[model samples]
Each structure stands twice: as C-alpha cells, then as structure tokens.
Target: MGDTLIDEPTDLSVRLATVFSQMTRVRTFRLMNSAERGPWPALLKAVFTTPSLTCLEIWESPWRRPEEKFTIEALELPQNYSSLQRFVYRVPFSDCFPRESKSYGRRDRVQGSVELSNLRVLASLICDSVEVLELPAELAFLLTHITYPKLRVFSVQGHEPLQLAEWAEILRSARQLREVHLQTPIGFTEWSKTSSNWIESNSIPTAPVPQTHSDDLIMRGLSNLESLTISNPLDPGKELFFQFLPYANLRTFSLKAFPPLSALGARWSGIHSQVLTSSEILCILKGIQLINLSTFEVSYSVDAEDGVMLSHISSSFPSLEKLEIHRYRSLAKYNSEYDPLVSMPDALATATNLQHLMLNLDFPERPYWRDDNLNPERYKVFHGFLESQVASPFTGAIPSLKTLGILCHDAFSSYWDTWEVSKTRKLVSRPPHAMSN
Candidate 1:
C-alpha cells in the first residue's frame, strides 16, 4: 500500500496523458508549484503529445526571476500548442513577468502569438487593472489574428481599450462568439467623450461606451447572443438599456447598480410611449418566454410608484417560475404612505405563478405611534383595507404560490409584528375554496 501510494501521482499523470491523447472536445491541465521548474518539461511533454486537446488551463505559483524576485510568465507555455479550443491562465500579474520584459508586451498579443490554432473560448483573463484609453497594438494584432468563428465565450479584464477600429473588426470577425464580459477600470471618463463619435462611425448608435467606448462594439458584435450581463455600476441609466434594447433575442439579462425607474422613464421619454408602457412590458415578457427564460431578477432603488410600475412590468412575465424583488433600503422614505399589511396582500394576489417569492419590506421596526396608541381613525382605515379588501382578493389569485419570504429591517420588527396580526386575520378568514391541502 505504501509503494502504491508513493507511485499514485506518476500513475495518475500517465493515465491523464493517455486520456488527453484521445480527447477531441475538452481537456484541462493544471499545475500548482513554480519553485521547481525541472518537472515542467516532463509535464509539457505529456500535454503536447496529445493533439486533440480543446481546453487547457495552466496555474502555477510565482517563479524566481534572475533578479531574485518571483514573476509572472515564469511558466511559459510550450511551443506548438495547437488544437487548443479554450485557454485560461490564472496567475498573479505581479509575480509572472518582469515589468521591463519586451516579450510581455500585451496580454492579447501573448495569447494570440501562442500556437493554439483552433482556440475558440477564452475566459477570466485576470490582470491588475484594465485600461480603456490606449490598448496595446500587439494585443490588437493578436485579437485580429486569433480565430473567433468557433468561439462561444470570451472575457477580458484589463485597463486598456482596444482601438475602435480594432474592436469593430473584432466584432465583424467573431461571428459565433456569443458571451462576452469586459472589465475596464480605467480611462472610462475620457473614453466616454469619444464614444458617440465611435458609435456613429461604426454605424452602431448605441449608448456612449463609458470608458473604452466598447459598449456599442460589444452590442454590435454579440448580435446573436441570448444572455448578457453588464457590471458597469457607473452608468446604469435608461440610455444604456435603450442602446441594447434592439437585441430582441436576449432572454436573460442582468445589470448591477441600475438607476431608478423614474430616471429610466425620463430619459426614454420619446420612446416612453412605445417602450415603457404595459404593452411593451408584455412584449418583453413574450420575448422572455419564447427564449425559455424561467428566472428573472431586477433590483433597483425606486419609489412606491416605481415599485408599482415595476410590478406592472413583472405581471407581463407570466412564464417566470422564480422572481426576486430586491428593494433597496434607500427607497424606504417612499414607503411613508404605504401600509405594509395592505400593500402586501394585493402584490401577493397578483403573482400567481410565483413558486418562490421574497419581499424585503424596508420599514422601521417600531412605528412612531404604538399600535395601542395609534390614531383610532387611521387604525380603522388600515384594518379595513386588510380585512375587507386585501385578504378577500388573495383567495383565488395566488393559487400557485408555494413559498413566501418576508424580510424587514430591525427597526421595523414591531411593525412586522403588527403585520403578522394581519396574517392571522388572513388565515381565519380564508374562504373554504382557498384552503390548500
């Protein structure tokens, strides 16, 4: 057992190499240590011997440079690395290559120059920062030469924005490339200025790309894509949505730090009559169903009226199986006029297909007025709405709802307790026809 255990890695490596040789679709090779370089040549021999490897990922620890510091690019890929379909490298930028080395001109060039002829998918290209102003020429050349016809996913993280012409050409070249995630942290402000010109010149009049002005480039290029996620927190306004709204094929969409619904309404005023109405929301829902989207999520900070508008929009998505509504705490001020006990029953009544529902009612735990000391007239109005109107409407409307989650702020625990009293009333008054098994 001891001898067998000692030989396990060798045995495994041999078995992996044998399997790698026969693979035609997918392959992965990972390494951990960089202190010892002697074993790499043998590993490379095993990796290169397989001519059909389509996916490759190499991870190595920092390598000791001649200057005695560890560096990236220490574990250089072997030459003749053909047949690679996707390649990923997750090594620290600070540790890989020397800052002065000309060989490490730009990441794209480094990737493009590799002998991975059949490469199709590239993802998670991590760098210290991304530039959106001046992209490296070598990287641009590499992007132009790399085969993208068969590529399905591509993600780049860096500060530089590839030249506008280069990006246009890339969009034109990568016909089959579908999913793209770009993270550019720098030069966005300057880049935003020329974004309009770039879009006009490219004939893709989408929103001004924030930094790299690549937003339009991305939209134009990934025309056939069905899923898109943009993480730009700087500009989550309606203009961004308008720019990409033409992509009727999108089924799954996500935006981080999106602007308020009112802002969205104001910016698209001309199209508001066409796109922001109930009919438009229904059309988007139909599109989502046609594309087979089962999950939809939208989180933003807006007022109660905006929430109402959003709810109306959500009603259009009849096929949605799971829905998550995240109301920011910042919007709590607008809840001053909204009585939780009354508002919830109506909202719950409308979401008939909801299998799971989460409502984060951002209210203070204790109302300024105690339930005992509450104005008799206001209490009557609130209680009347819950008892006579809200609870009665819920019986037949939410037949399909299985799970309901209610989250409240710590300060609003007392108010929630009062809200629970309303729930008790609901159970007691549940019509015989509304009782679930």
Candidate 2:
C-alpha cells in the first residue's frame, strides 16, 4: 500500500471503492493515522461492508490532537455485517468523541462523534459477533450504548479513572467473558454510587434492577472470570481488589505494580515507595487459597521477607506450574546476607508440582560492564554465584522442577540466563557461558 493509495488524492473515494470491492477475501483491516484527518467515508464503508472481514482496527496517533479545521465524521454504518468478530479502536492521547468548544468568542464544532443511530446499527452488527474487544477508557460509553452478547475477552487501557458503573455494565452484558485485562492510570478513583443513564436504560418499572451496593454489583460481575490481569500502582484500588478475590473463579491471575511516573516534575523520593510492599502481598496470600490458579506473576519491592512470601505462595497454591517473581528495586546496595537469591530455592521447596520458574532480580553488585568494559573472569564469578547459591540449591529442593531462569538486571542491560535440569539431577546452562576451573 503506497501513501497515494489511501492519501487525499482527487479520486481517493472512487479508487478505494474499486480496490476494496475486489478484496472480497480480506479478513482484517487496519486504518491508522493515514485516515485520521478525514472521515474517508468510502474507506469506512468498504470495511464495514466486507462480507468476510473478521477484524477491524481504527487508530489515531496517541499524541495527535484534532486540527483547527477538523470535522467530525458522521457516516452511517451498513445495516448488517456479522462477520466482524474482533474490533480494536485506540485514541490514547485524544478523546474519541470530542465535545463542542467555545474559544476566542467563537463556537467550534465537535472534533469526533459516534452518533447514537450509528451506535445502534453497530450494535446490531457487532454486539452479537464480537468476541474480543479493545478500547481506551475514553470510549467506555460504547459499552453502555452497545451490548455484547457473545463477548469472551475484553481489554481496556485508560488515561483517566473509570467509574464503577461502567465497569459493572461491561461484565453485566458480556455474560460469557472469560478473560479481562485492565491497565489503569496511576491514581485510583472511587467507583461512583449511581449512574442514572445506565440504571434507567436497563431498568423496568414493574421489576427494576435492585439498587444494591456498588461493591456487590462489581462482585457479581467478576464471578465468572477465569483469568484477570490488573496493572496498577495498588493505591486505594488494592482494598477494592480484596473484595474481588472471593467472587472470582480465576485460573490465572497477574498483579503487577504499575510503575510510577519518572518525569522531571515527579518526586523521586515518593516513587521508590510506590511498588507493592511486603505486608500488602502477604495480606493477600495469608488466608486466601487460589486453588485453581496455575500461573502467577507479580512485581514487588525486594526485601528480606520475600523468601517467606514465596513459601506461603507455594503452600497456598499447590497446583502451581509456572511462576515468575520480579523485584522492582535493586539489591546492589544491600549486604549479601539479605540477598534473595540465596534463600529463594529453599523457600519454594513446597511447590512440588512446579515445572518452570523465573526470577528477575537486580544484580547484587554493579558489574564493570557499566563502564563499557567486559571482564570474562568477573562474568565467571557471577555465573558461579548462580550455580552455587541458586541453581545447585534449586536442583535438590523441587523434584518436579525442569527449567529455571535467573534474569539479572543492571543499570546497563539485562541478561536472562536459563538452566535446564538433567535427569542426573544436575543443572547445566542451556547456552554455556565462560566458567572457571
């Protein structure tokens, strides 16, 4: 596809119509920045009208703002096109439906809009067939406007806080949803108590939906989830997360501490305290038993008590097969006695069913590589440190363990060295590195 093929040429519409009409077998289409400036009515028409198209992605540059002369596209969608089963639309930096503005005493029209009528038609065509959907939080209104009867996977990334009612409605309508991934903003917001629009639209006079507590609504929505991955800094949201555990039927769960902002204006002192703390993690695994959970990953602040936490996890989830633990801060400043690498293997000794494990930790000491100098002897000592402190201990602790990876990170680079356990009960590096006699 040349730029001229989709760019604003005089015969763009006619050319697109002819070209797309012949693409009868086209199953996926991606419309990006090239189509941001104009509605390209004919191009959109071709996409929605394609009988075999199963996926459609419409995106705009994350940093691109609407131009001064921008006009909202008010094009109508075709009556029916059920072949589309996946849709992804992203406008991370800009609003999807920009509202009208008044500047310099002059009123400006809305920059982007999804008319109600078009949403209705889109629902008829898409809501029934769309099994996977991804959108930015700014366009969450679409969830209320459109009902997804067969949706199974949903993902959303937000630039701001998303209200509770919106979250409830998403799970309410998608009754069969199995997987949900949410990337929330830095700070958490309280879920709103009520939303007249969502309530009245679905409520009936004779038997209105019960006006239960907002927490209950969210709890019911999470009951059927099999896998849930949340990326947040674990602010006030961690309290709400505690409520979700009992109701969720999750088989895979990942809780990542979303990194705090490192921009100049941000405080470096406060940022170090942002990662998940030892107490917070222990609180979660204390009394709760995620029996069905097989795969787990978490990012936490490194401390001496990490080994204790890992032991708790092994006992709590006996069916564990794959596990990954990431240390967000460096161990370079800490003394060797407090090094997690030494105690990690003995800690996870209870996970007898475990087959694979990965640990991402900062180096105990800064390597000379930071100065652009590589010493084979220094690397050998580091390899020996792992063979004795990590690999050798792990080989005897867990009989079922087959593969282990020690990902060491420094200021300069990350090296993921993997060791394969042989039947002779010995650990050998897959890609052998320099070793001392």
Candidate 3:
C-alpha cells in the first residue's frame, strides 16, 4: 500500500487484506505527514478491510492548511464494522450535513467547505467498538450521533467549546469513559460559528431547554471516570469542568499551569493558571479526598510556590504511588514574571507508597538574598531556605521507592549524594524516563 501510486493500485483492499490477515498482531495503521493526499479510495478500502486493526490515524499534509474540501466519496459499510479501539482523525470541515439526518446544524458556508459525511461514515463504522476517540472540533458534533459502550478515553482538538447538550449526550452514551482530556479551550465558540455564519437568520431555539438535565447527565456519566487532563485552558468560562470536580472514580488527574491571569489575552477566559486560584486548589483537594488516587501530575509554567500546595499534596492522596510536579522554563530572566518557589522538602514526605517521583525543580547556582518591597523578610527567608533546604525524605520515608528522576540543572548537583547514600536504593543521575503527567 505504501509503494503503490494513486492510479497504479488495483484491487488494493483485497491485496492489503490478504497481507494483513497473515499478521495477527499488527494493530496500528497510520498514514501521516504525506506530501500528497495519497489515493483516498485505496486508503479507505484498505482501512475498511482490516478486521484486526485497533488504532487508525490519518492526517492531512502536515504543511498544508488549505480551505478543506469534502472530497471523500461516501461508501456503504457492512452491517458490522467492529475491531477498532483507537482513532485520531484531524481534518478541517465546512458546513455540510449527513444524508441519514433530517436537519444538520443550520451552518452557513462556502462551495468548497468540508462536509461531515466522511467523518460521520468513519465514526458510524466504529461506533460500537472504538474505546478511544480523538477528533477535530468539526466532528465533535458526531459525538452525539454514535454510541460507544466501551469508550473510555476521549479527547478533542480545535479551539471550540463543545455544545453542552450534545457533549452530555455523548458522555451519556460512553458509559465507560475513564478519562477525559481537553486542550486549548475557546469559550462560547463552536465549529460552525468559527467556520462560517449561520444559514438561518433566526439562530435562537424557540424552545427553552433545561440546563440542569445536561449537567445531571454529564455528572452521572463522569462518576465512572478515573483520570482527567486539561491543558492550556483559558480562564473566565470553564463551567463544565468545575462540574466534574466531584467525580466518583477519578483517581488520576493532570493539569498544565500557565502564566497568571494578568497574561491573558482579550479573548481568553479567566482560568486560574498561576498559583492556581484557591478554588482550583480546593478542587484538587476535593479530588484527593474523594478518590484514593494512585498517580497525579501537575505542570507549572511560571509560578508554583511549593509551600502549602506541597503540604496539601503530602497530606492528601496517601495511596499515591507515582507523583510528578514539573516546572519548565526555569530561569531568573523572567524573575518579575513568576513568583519564586519556596523549598518545602518536608512537606512531600507524607506519601508513604510513592515509588517514582519526578519534580523538575532546581536551586539557583548563585543564591542572592535581595530585599523586596513586598514581604522583604519572607522573600529573604525563602531565598535562604532555597540555599539551605536540600535534605529530602525520598529514601527512608518512601520505603517502596525505587526510581527518582529530575531535570538536570546546575547548582542542584549536591543532592546526588542524598540519593546515592540511600538505605536501599541509589539516587539516579538519569533513568528510564516515563510519560509526562
């Protein structure tokens, strides 16, 4: 299939099927970064014929960002199209409806605008079996159209905030969803709204719908989730996520902390990124209280004062086996831009079961004690604390620990002996890296 040209292939699906049938363990089929849109018919045929394939990833030309054209010729699928488990489909769309539906959203559009037929066809085929779904914003609408009983992990791309009702319906269908990851949220934006104007002049729904039903449906579905991740969220409008704060089974949570609210753009929502607002911290505490999490990861961009937060983390999540608190872009060039971190080593000693810990924190090579206009004594104490606080309880306290990892930075090399002279385990200069939290 990779060698065959667009017109050179003949009965491609049959040949590909014959080849793939012999290899039982071959699960992933990916066609990414192609300079040209490789023979769509042959590609589709090959995909449709793979019975054992678990993951399918298809991306448009990596360098091409053209006005998307709905060129996929819709084909009839068999009564049963099952085996797929993961699918990542990223393609722009225009305003077009499905043939099976009576009314598609009243989206106004252009002639070459992408349609939903191609995406709908792909989704409908794998609706019953796919467990993990990642789609672009345009096809988020299709989430409501399919019912995936085994679906456990879901993620969405594009900047649009999903329609609450449609999203609730999707969640209701995915009763097994264990994790939900949302990235780069845009408040009050929809695929149709961003792509084009409305086809109908009257954009209002005549009937008043109850918002509580959506919330109820969403919360009920989230009770089964075990993990959740949100990255680069704009502040101001994140009502749906706050609703997920009290998940029943959520044990692992991951969030990316960005600059403070002062850095937000005009269009951005008010997300408490820096020093995570008290409410956000409360949510984390609630998650810790509600579930006995085995792992949790948090990424800090600018300011993550490790004082009370570490104490809270130390006290909460006693069952935590893996914990990661990463701070990147750590230099003093933006000294005013970020709040300095307080070294509170004793605060993290409470996690009794922790085995693997990765905290990308480092002390300055040259400890300069300077007085500040605000909290002059507090700032001086913290600076002195950073210079002196290197003793960590990663060994004896965490008896189950084996591996410890941190970003290699200058000045923090003295802690090497602390890990090297451990009672049972050795401090590692470098170890096999694990996935980011």
TM-score of 2: 0.69
lDDT per model vs. reference: 0.39, 0.58, 0.53
How would you encode candidate 2's per-residue C-alpha lDDT over 289-339 as one tens digit per residue?
A: 788788887767766667778888888887889887776556657537555
Candidate 1 Cα errors over 4 Å, as ranges? 1-26, 30-45, 48-54, 58-85, 89-145, 157-167, 182-220, 233-245, 257-294, 302-306, 316-319, 324-327, 330-437
Q: Pick the candidate with the highest TM-score.
A: 2
Model 1, residue 183: distance off in Å is: 5.7
Residue 370, candidate 2: alpha-carbon lDDT = 18
Tens digit of per-residue lDDT, candidate 1, span 1-437 = 01112112556557766876776554545454443321233344466456655445543322222222221233233333345566544221222223453322123222222311212112112111111111222233234533345555554433334454545556655667565443332123333333233322323233334645556655667577655544332332323433444455655554322222212212211210111322333333344332344455544444445435455544755555555444444534433445433454455455556554444333443233324454556544544544344334444346655443333222122212122223332424221111000
TM-score of each: 0.44, 0.69, 0.67
The numbered model that scores best in lDDT is: 2
Model 2 clash tally, residue pairs: 0
Model 3 residue 233 lDDT score: 37
Q: What is the Cα-based lDDT of residue 269 in candidate 1?
A: 18
Clashing pairs in 3: 94-114, 235-269, 235-270, 235-271, 236-269, 236-270, 419-427
Q: lDDT, candidate 3, residue 117?
A: 42
